[model samples]
Target chain A: MAQEHTVKSYDEELNQLRSMISRMGGLAEAQLTGAIEALTERNAEKAQRIIAADRSLDILEQEIESQAIQMIALRSPMADDLREIVAAIKISSTLERIADYAKNVAKRSIVLNQSEHVKPAVLIPQMVELTKVMLKDALDAYIDRDAQKTIMVWESDKGVDELYNSLFRELLTYMMENPRLITPCTHILFIAKNIERIGDHVTNLAEIVYYQVKGETLDMNRPKSDDTSFAVVPPPANT
Target chain B: MAQEHTVKSYDEELNQLRSMISRMGGLAEAQLTGAIEALTERNAEKAQRIIAADRSLDILEQEIESQAIQMIALRSPMADDLREIVAAIKISSTLERIADYAKNVAKRSIVLNQSEHVKPAVLIPQMVELTKVMLKDALDAYIDRDAQKTIMVWESDKGVDELYNSLFRELLTYMMENPRLITPCTHILFIAKNIERIGDHVTNLAEIVYYQVKGETLDMNRPKSDDTSFAVVPPPANT
Candidate 1:
């Protein structure tokens, strides 16, 4: 009966950790969306708010990381519990990076605010929405231990990439057509690139989920042209 | 006598691991230089070679990571030895990322090969050289455990960032002045951004060194705005 109670407590701690991470993920996703919105609407205050908000996420990251170390040292977990803790570490790091990228977007948006709006910012917000959805879904997959949903999020990244490529081409055309518009357009380009990277981080989270569930490595490298599906390739032959 | 023998063996392993990481760092630095040269010269074959060269670095990264893990598992090191292993893991990841950014530069060069040269690729090669020196110096600090030298490299990153900003503005102007130059100019912009990111990764390595030597956290997220001094930031007050 005592062993059963200890197991239950471990499970509860694990769940709480996951919940904390998911909350952090939601905050980061909102930051990305708000940053892009601020850029499009030329809302400097909103952009500043996003930048300031990152400090709390940074604090949360450090807190969770220490908590994880404490858990590892105290519980000495193995198997699934071990995997869960490791996943939490990786996910926290990735989310911190995502928040950093969003902060970059907001910073550039502040720079571009002084200049005229170059384009409608149509494709960027759409792309941001898609990436936000991917981020949400990936975190949900982790919380629910839904491997299939994780795979779906991984596949969704390709769509985000395609959108970014198209946006890049369009922005290039804009800069080409009007020499005066280069500064603001280039700032917009960075904003778009940051969103695309957020998508990449979401894909990374998905791969971590796959690894924890399967006890196998997943290829998180950029896709090669020869690979038809973006599915995680198995561990290399030598390994 | 047994303790002395074990110490000797541990010293040997530590020396070997340090040597390997330094060698890997040198290769990554050379790749950065080669990638930038390929961009400036618009050498498609050279760019192709740089792309191919990254595979070896990837293999080396994996080898170093596994060796570090093995050392940790076998020796159960404490204090500096443990910190050294952890730094190895972080440094290898940063080096791999630097190589990836280099490959991105090479890939952009490949696309720019067929187009007319945009702006003589002047600022970019300089930025790349500065980043290479930073990477080299950071590794030197790691091998020697020279916290002072590591701080210098960390400071140098701001110069690289300034150069990147200037290049971004220059390229933006070029694209705006000549709409026909948009395609190739955008490629150059990406190359510049990649080099700038490489510089950031090198700074990250330096930060790891600072942590390893001083056992204190450095604020890596702070914007590098005219700061030249290194002071150890205390952990959060709440913690």
Candidate 2:
């Protein structure tokens, strides 16, 4: 009976860890949406709120880490339970990073508000919308232990990268055409880049979810199409 | 006697994990240095070599992760041993990211060689040198399990960010002066950003080391001086 009680309590601990991860994911998703909204609406107040809220994710990550470590040492969970614990730890950290990207976007949005809006700023919202879908799906996969969803999220990140490339060219062109646009366009570029990176992190979350469920690494070479690094836009003919 | 044998094997396993981390850290340091050399020398072949070498770090990270998980499950390590194992996993992943940044620098170096060197490019080596010292000390702290060294490394990252801020402003000024320099200067900007990010990750390593040694999180607020996000360099008066 004592052994059975101990097993039951260990199961409860595992459940609690899952819930903590779930809560953290929810917070991160909210933060991402809030940041993008703040950027598009030029709502510095909202951005500041999102920035302040980021501390919660960090605190949650620490809690998850300490809890996971204690569970590992005390319960000696094996196989599936161990996999779930490890995944929770990694996913929590990933969520923290995603929230950090959101915070960065918020910070940049505050700076962006100081200048005239660049034309390419419109593209960021579109890119962020797609990223949000992937993040939501990745989190769902985690909660449901659905490996198939992870595979789908993994395949979809290419879309985000492709959008980023086009935005990259457009921003560069604008900066080239009007040198005055350089400062604002640069901030937009980084904000878009942050969104793109968030998509990549969501893909990582998908892989972790797949590993937790399947006990195997997601071995597929993720299609990467972010070519902005090689991009060189020539100055306008007048220049 | 049997229990003693088990303890001895566990000790060996922990030592192996530590050595694996040390080896990975060494590789990361070498890759950072090589990437910078490739940038300064404009050596496409060396850049390609550095990019190719990044795969090894990824492989090492996976190996360290699997070994750490196995030890945790099988050895049931407690307290300090457990903290070290967890730190190894986290540190190994951070090292992998540092190597990824180096690979990105190498990739950009190849593109940078295609264009005439921008004047701001000269500042990159200085930023990287500071980052390299921090990386070295952070790794040394990890291997030595010296919490004091972690504190020092944490405090020193401010210098790297200050350098990066200057480099950031200089690049923008160059890009504004010559439209043609925009392409190359953008790459330099990103390369410098990569080095600055590497410095941040090294600071993370220091925190991880401190935690691993002291069994407590480093709570001191790190000094951050990177202000590039808010900078605005106007175009030349003639423009």
Query: Which candidate number maximizes DockQ?
Result: 2
Model 2 lDDT per residue over B81-185, tens place: 888898999999999999999999999998888887787777788888888888899988987778999999999999999989888878777777777777788
C-alpha RMSD over true interface residues, each candidate: 17.1, 1.6
Q: What is the C-alpha lDDT of each candidate?
A: 0.76, 0.88
Which CAPRI category fits model 2? medium
List, in order, the clash count of every candidate structure. 1, 0
Candidate 2, superposed: residue stretches over 4 Å from native:
A1-8, B1-8
Ten-residue stretch with the least lDDT total in model 2 chain B: B1-10
Q: Return model 1's CA RMSD, one decimal.
A: 9.8
lDDT of 1 by residue, B83-160 (tens): 787678678878988998998888878777777777737888789889888998998898888889988998899889
TM per candidate, chain B: 0.87, 0.95
Per-residue lDDT of candidate 1, residues A1-239 (tens digit): 43555444777888788888988988888888888888888899998999899998888887776566556645766667766776776788889999999988888877777776776368988888898889999888877878889888888888888877777767766665555666676767777888888888888898888887777766566542211111111222322
* Candidate No. with top lDDT: 2
Considering the two chains of model 1, state its CAPRI-style docking category.
incorrect
